[model samples]
Target: MKKEDLKKLHSSIEANFKLLEPFRKNRLEVIKEYVGSHFSDHGSEKQLPFNMIRLFVDIFTRRLVANNPSSLVTTKPLRLRPSAATLQLGLNHLIEEIDLQRDLETAVKDALFSVGMVKVGLNHSASVEIGGVLHDVGQPFMNAVELDNFVCDMSVSRWEDMTFIGDRYRVDLEFAQTKMFVGSEDAKKLTATGKAVQDNERHSTKELLEKRTGFDAEEYRPKVELWDLWLPLENKVITIAAGQLTDVVLNEIDWDGPELGPYHQLGMAEVPGSVMPLPPIASHRDLHELVNFTARKIQRQIHRQKEILGVASGGEGDIDRIMNSDDGDVIKLDHPDLVKDFKLGGVDSLNLATMVNFMELFKQMSGNLDSIGGLGPQSDTLGQDKMIADSSSVQVADMAARVTKFTARIVRDLAFYLFEDPLINLPLVKRVPGVEGVEIPVTLTAADREGDFLDYNFDIDPVSMSHKTPGGQLNKLMTVIQQVYAPLRPVFQSQGITLDTSQLIRSLAQYADLPELDGLFISDDGEALLDDQPVGSHERTLDPNTTRTNIRINRPGATNSDRANAFVQGLLGQGNDEQRAVAARATG
Candidate 1:
């Protein structure tokens, strides 16, 4: 507006272009050329006002391009000229020898029609080629006052007698006039700033059109034919998702050296020792970050599936169940049962905990990235590394496989216990206390038992298991157990005791083909199968002697049943022969 202000604006524009330079090349130069050619008119003074208008258009166009370059095509500079009405009036005033109002009007109308065509064509071309809809749309408003005056004059009663204006010109004039007329109403509507009034107007317009035509206005509404320049919605979504994931991964892995420390401060600290050493750091933070990122993505996918299933089932679902499950309940140290039930061990639990932690870290990182405006090349490079770590399959097959294996292990260790005792079936049985007509019966077979135990155990040592069974036999075994025991495991695990191999074998013996007890042993050692079936087994045994007899105990004891029963009275009488014999035996 003023010389100083204009200079400031120009400088601001240059700075903005510099800031955006990394995204593209010479954008600022192109913008400057456009503004100079259209507004300054190759150093001419005659079209200064018109040049100013052009400069405004160029600035807006460049901004739109910077925000999203795919929307508009770059083109040769436009030639600015006088509007049709201006040109027609000048021609008539300069060249006429006689009164030629009627002819002059016709010429004006034709010129206006030609100008409209040129403007519309340019607008459409830019939208289709370079994405200039906003720019061209803004242009028509520059001559709004003149166009409205011309249309109003044409619409006057006496003007009806004049038919010299060609059909094409007449149609163009009518369209422009109608649009301008409606725009005036729209301006008033916008001023209200009330949502109710806006909504009423929208509905009123539709109703009015429907009443006049006996058809819905929406039925005939024009479809927006978006030009090729605009990116598809799907593509944008994918790009955003990828960038977000990449940024999250980078932050989670803490790829930037000493930046991982508290407050990102780096320096030597005083120590009592003779020498002070730097904190140990990972050599390849990027590599570790990539692994963590891929793992988190996989974890998210699994949870997402669980969430979807929960929604589909019309219940609070598994996620809610897990959250509300007794596992969350605080237990006293005196509550041995609760303590035993909640204990989670081995690699499966550790891996799951790690995955959950990583996912949360990634989420926090994503938030930070969003706050900073978005991911850039640095983030994408990190994402590429993560992709490689998880395998280069865009389909996420590798991730899916990892999830499947992990899920199988969970099912085996937790679910196999449903087969131990009929009481364990309570966890698997689904029933609404008052509404239920029949309770679902869940049963687990021996093969299911063995498969689950093996799976759970193997998953605890995946690297070793993978080496032992490179053919994926262990994975297959785990999968089968998962499938068969899935319906029953949740029920049993809910009751506290883990479903081990003994429980599975016992459950299978009830309803399905029972394999030989000897076959269940992977080793030929003479250890009793039930007692020596590892610590995770349902039953344990003890060796009997001639002086003492073995008795089955409710819970496994330190020495099984081989020791004389201390709870028994008179068994250790001081002088009785039998008591003396027992006392000597106990002392021995």
Candidate 2:
């Protein structure tokens, strides 16, 4: 890490921040309008600006994000190979081996920061008063569309516990403010090199640094909390300064940006389409204004609905007399001929129609009508509803997939760092078809760290992706089941073939996301079914909870054929006696 290198990253910060001027300005207006309180009242005395429309879209944006990860990044084990066996027994072992889910979740969050951190250094230790008060949990989280907001004063989410350097002193992720828009140039430079840049005037970092050196303080600045002032200097030296008020470079290293890029900011996905870095929020400003005007007009009409009278001259008492609420009230006027009357505003269906037209136009312009669907069950066909619900999920998943590439790359490079350590110890796992799993104690060699030793990949979870509740997983499951397994079913059964239920469950889990799928021969408490015996004396019920409980049965004695038969029986039981008789005869 050279001073020139740190300076290069700083230069990138400045150039990128300057370039983001338009996006920064535009995002403020969008979020402002979305929050429904930041608009002008158009100089009118009647200030009735309805924010219903913007609020709807605001919630919609978050819903899009909340809908993301489950579909956008499948929880199914992110494998080292695409076609690897789930039954390999060692695959799940590999997931535990790599600590995939926990690390990857945080990594995804960091990747998000990296995108913003590249242009505007991320505020790792930053926290507002409201802290984790999320905009909308219903919407997607860490969405790329909200990237502009993250760069500005908008407090979006960040990855927690993401440190790239070695453990003892390295703090990967911290809460800090983005110095690109709000802090000093030196602070911004400090931030570019993966430091937690913050408003140092208020923290204990200054005292800690000074106290460490046991020097009387005068010439120093407060750095971020829990962080030593690690600086990269021009002579290709990176140092961890340990003094309070002076630079005492403790440890320095010679390193390139490439080695650190993956470790530091491995994942950050940028919002797509030009104007580059301009979010979808940029397009909705005009539409918000339009809706604002429409609301104002509606409010004006309400005010005008009251009868207004004018005269050549009238006192306050006279006006009050005219405004009397009595059913049979009369008022005296000196100038009868001078009296002028104005009634309520006329019915303008055209304005209402115009507002609807504008709304449609806005949706079309923004291309966000994917969330709008028919209210009645008959309004949209099943396929049409599924298409509408899954469209955004699909698009969002694809966008995140791009970010996954960087994450994979960073995780790959981390192998060299982790494996090179003498203390490193990981089980060497190998898959053998039709064989028992074995773990061999293995030590890393220099050769294993030199090349692309791992080939990990990602796939989106389409099954867990749909926007609707209850039916999303089922919908996707049914679809893939119909396409992939339905045709194979008759053929397999006719040829006396069978499918591995666990393997099928794993494959379908990518699309179905059924919690019940994990219940295969396992109790609700997660104990093996074979290990459990029913305690009939515990809580006996004279009446069954169902017409029959066969398909629902998962006690110790139930077998695959019994489950299948129970499902068929339950279907027949749902019908009348005649149907049941026919079913019984057919089965016999």
Candidate 3:
């Protein structure tokens, strides 16, 4: 990289950062609501800030957890084959191994707080050791980049049309010299381009803090600003030193990672005619201010003491004594009408009512946070309340969908890292689809994964990504059992296809959100069993030396319904054998 080129890159980076000043300020304001910052108008005392922004964002974050791989992202094979099935299983386990859910929680909070953007990148040289030998392991990581630390082309209207994106971060001077620039000879002699250098003592973060937060860090040790600019057209990433060092090129490397240069952008609301996005909180800013202002006003109104005056007709001694009188204290007056007390009202009920209205409006505008949280005024019946919750979930659903799409893109990059590497090999297990108590161990080698990267379609299970309570899961399961299975079971039985209850349990347990219920049947030994099998069962008959048990026939005593009715009786040791078994299973 030439010094002149480095100068141009540095200038472009600074200009882009300057273009994002308004967005950065907006983010800082929202962050203040999160951390509870003092207002400029308020005095030295920190006035209580109504953080409805934090409240809503946090609630929505809890609602957006990708609790499982099926919830995060799914890879669908273009061609239906055994290889593709194996590949899909590998990808699913990879999602868990990487702990994408936890990273996404961190990223989702950042997106809600800022302009709603998350970046995905691969770290190829992550340090690990095997038998005392250090190895560089490749892995993908996601970042919720700070608003002030990132810059993009402002002239572009679409993300795809944007020329470049860059990240700016502070690096310790000693670390940069000893670690980053140790092997490079350019550190000894700095090349100077014909360009003015930015002041080493100042950066936007420090300046923004001093201006907005009134905090000074002048005594802190100096650090260097490092810039990583990704050029999509060239498919390369370049690093440069900012601050005191003007137009100093650090390093440049080819980016064979994602086509868009290892960085992906995600946002909630779309901003017309701009590549940048409008955060959901930005829309709620005005309402948030109104709420806080009214709350403060109401607080002051209630805290104010009532004014009382005494009209004295005679000596003022009695008036003073009467004004300062405690309980059971009596004051001697010269005349009966010596002093008259006049009291004024302290607070108005109207102010408090208005404040409540403002808060309600804030919640309504921000996707009815109160209703979603099961608080405030709700519908008369359970169904109506559910309807209201469903209606309010629309906005939160949209946010979650955006996260799902963002996660899909990240998963693609992660898959690329795994499939593209010929050296990557993984030992995995895939459960047989219809077979009960069966999982086959398989190994996926580079040869198995070698193919066009576009062979799989990426999908995100939006419904799964949205969290549900245990009660909700149970309700859903019951609905499926009653509405679908119950109606179709007889029809299938007539066609000589009897429903396998054990298989049904295993399949449902694999995907159901109820972990405790699944644990009841899926034992610690990795074997799934609803109950013990009788003698001469298929599992026991597999042993050639095992003797076959004689079959015995008996008259049917009670139907399933009768046994169900007798379950309680069986618990009291008064019912038949079948009813007792049913009761035991129920209790177990």
Off by over 4 Å in 3: 38-46, 66-80, 126-136, 171-183, 187-224, 307-343, 434-437, 492-588
Worst 10 residues of 1 by lDDT: 235-244
Better of 1 and 3 by lDDT: 3
Can you give the TM-score per candidate against the true fold?
A: 0.14, 0.45, 0.72
Q: Write the per-residue lDDT of candidate 3 for residues 1-588, one digit (tens) a residue.
A: 677866776677778877887777667666666655554432213344577877878788878764753523223544435666676667777777766777678667777766545555555455522111233465555555566668888889999987778776555455456555657665544332211133221234324444433222442544555667788877788766655466566777888887756677767878899888777787887777777777787677767756666655565666666668888977676664755667565555555545556666777787878667654435434565678778988867788778888877877777776667776688998888766579889987887764466765656566656667656766787788779866686575577565455545644665564445544664446665555542212121124355669876543343222333455354345678766654354221
Q: Candidate 2 residues 161-207, lDDT tens each?
A: 22211101222112222321244222233321212222121122222
Q: Total clashing residue pairs per candidate?
A: 16, 29, 0
The residue-by-residue lDDT of candidate 1 on 1-588, one tens digit each, is: 234633443344234323323212222222232233344323221222222223223222221112100111111223211121222222222212112222222222222111110111112112121111232221111111111111111221332232111100111222222332243322221111111222221222222222233322433331111101101211110000110111111101111111111110111121233121121111222222443455555455555542212122333333454445584675333323222122222223334434444333432332221111111211224343344333322222332243234323322222222222222212133344545367754333232232212222212222221212223344455666778655565565677545466545544543344546535644346554444454345432223332656774342122101122221213323245543344244221
- Clash pairs of candidate 3? none
TM-score of 2: 0.45
Identify the runs in model 1 with alpha carbons over 4 angstroms from their true place.
1-220, 224-588
Best by lDDT: 3
Report lDDT (Cα) of residue 225, candidate 3. Answer: 59
- What's the C-alpha lDDT at position 176 in model 1? 23
